[model samples]
Target: MSTAVATRSGARRIRLDVRLLVLALVMAGAVGYLMYTGLQGTAASYFVTVSELQARASEVDGRRVRVGGDVVTGSIVRGGPGEPIHFRIGDGTSELEVVYSGVLPDIFAEGRHVIVEGLYRNGQPVQADSVLTQCPSRFEAAPTASSS
Candidate 1:
C-alpha cells in the first residue's frame, strides 16, 4: 500500500509540471506577437525632399512618404467650395504635382514651404493625405536695435 501511494504522488507531480510548461509557452508567444505588432505600428514614414523623391522614384513609388518643398508660384489651383485643390511643389531643380482634397490651411499659399504626406503614384500625381506648412518665423527672435 505504501508503494502504491508513492507512485500516485509522482504521477500527479509530473502532470502539474507539464501543465506549467504549456502555460509558459503560451504566455511567451503572446508577448512576442504584441512586440511585433507594436513595432509595425511605430514604423516611421520616409521623409525626403522633392529632388530626392525624384531620384528615388522607382524605389518609392506607391509608398507612403513625406516630401518637403516650396509650393511653385502660379501653380495653385483651387476648385469650388468643396472641391479638391491641385498644386505643384518644387525643390529648385525638380518638381512634383500634388493633389489634395481637404480644406486648405490659412497659411497655405503659393511660394510657401510645405510638407506633403501621401502616396506617390507612378506616372501620375501624388495623392496627398495631408498638407503641412511651416510658420515663416516661429524660431526667429525680433530684431533688437544696437545701442551704440
Candidate 2:
C-alpha cells in the first residue's frame, strides 16, 4: 500500500513538470513571432542607392524604396504653382533624376544630403512623396561677443 501511494505521487509530479515545460515553449514562440513581424514591417521599406536600384530595376521597380544621396549641384528646378519640383540626386559616381510634389523641408536645398522615399519604375525618375534632409553638422554658429 505504501509503495502504490508513493508511485502515484511521483507520476503526478512528472505530469506537472511536463505541462510547465510545454507552456514555456509556447510563450517563447509567440513572443518570437511577434518580434519577427514587427521588424518585417520596417525592413520592407529597404534602402538602396541609385546604382544599386539600377542594377536591380526588375526586382524593385514599382515598389516603394528609399534612396539616400546628395542633391546634385544645379540639378534642382522649382516649378510654378502646383507643379512638381525636379532634381537630380547622386552618389558621386552616379546620379538619378527625381520628381517630388510635396512641401519640401525647410532645410532642403541643392548640395544637401537627402533621403527620398518614393516609387521607382525602371528607366524613369523616382516619383518622390517625401524628401528628408540631413541635419547640418553645426546646428548654429557660435555667437560673437558683439552679437551676444
Q: Estimate each model's TM-score.
A: 0.67, 0.72
- Give candidate 1's error at residue 134 in angstroms: 6.4
For 1-148, candidate 2 gives per-residue lDDT tens digits of 9999999999999999999999999999999999999999988666777778778889998898799899999999999999999999998878999999999999998899999999999889999998989888776888778754
Please give, for residues 73-140, the per-residue lDDT of candidate 1 as tens digits. 99999899878899999999998999999877899999999999988977788999899987787788
lDDT of each: 0.90, 0.91
User: How much is 96 displaced in model 1, in angstroms?
Assistant: 2.1
Candidate 1 pairs with clashing backbones: none
> What is the Cα-based lDDT of residue 29 in candidate 2?
100
| Deviation in Å, model 1, residue 72 alpha carbon | 5.0
Give the RMSD in angstroms, all C-alphas superposed, for model 1.
Answer: 3.8
